[model samples]
Target: MLPNKSDSRRRLNATGLSTGDYNKVNTDTTETDGFVNEQWVAPNVEEPIPWKTIAIILVLFVGGTICICCATLDWLADVNQDRSDRIGALTIIGALTIIPGGYYLYILLCILMHRTGYTMDDIRRLG
Candidate 1:
């Protein structure tokens, strides 16, 4: 069964930690006989995605489309002004589609590479 949000919160509170609740940092070091305790540590929360990876992927996708559109705009503008514009429009459409298609294909390749169970030994053998 899937756990609900409140159940998780209760579990955290039981452990002396609260989730999604505002609380102040307890930096007061546990002490004994005027000696500082060094063993106590706060539990770790899940790490979030790094901003660099997100920026890279976002830039790649957006830059690819911007490149394709900028390249085709001139041809598209000409096509819009012409009476017999079927061939020109079709060519521009095909050019625009290639950018997104290539981006998706690269994403597919990354997924496939991750899933093939290609151990380091396998990669070394291929090389």
Candidate 2:
């Protein structure tokens, strides 16, 4: 007999086990499938929030803010103080900070997307 696609997907979502494997275990029983058996259905566990990704997002926001401040300071130094040291140093630091901030933002976006059921393959396919 053919397996039902929606039911299989729902079972996978619940226990991460395929319907074929579930059927194999109950072959000797009177049941054709364990759909009617309460024991066969496992309780769903709550998925934990991605706290590290969230923390990284906050850190990236702060780093981006600092980078902007540094760029502003460099600009002020260049315009008023006419100092090359502050401008060069702050410019390099700001540029470095911006690269990582952008990367972190991308990671946060990926994390959020995955929570919404978009797998890495799905994300890559979209790109």
- Considering every candidate listed, which one attains the maximal lDDT? 2
- Residue range 1-127, candidate 1, lDDT tens digits: 5432222211124456545674332336232233223323445556543445444545545665655565467555665556335445544665565555455446545644886744222211111
| Pairs of residues at least 3 apart in sequence or in different chains that clash in candidate 1 | none
> What CA root-mean-square deviation does each model show from the true structure?
15.8, 11.0
Question: Each model's TM-score, in the order given?
Answer: 0.28, 0.41
Task: For each candidate in the order shown, give its overall lDDT on alpha carbons.
Answer: 0.46, 0.55
lDDT of 2 by residue, 1-127 (tens): 5443223312223566655553223334343433544445567666555566556556755776686687687677566667766666766776666676666566657766666654332322111
Question: Can you give the lDDT of residue 126 in candidate 2?
Answer: 15
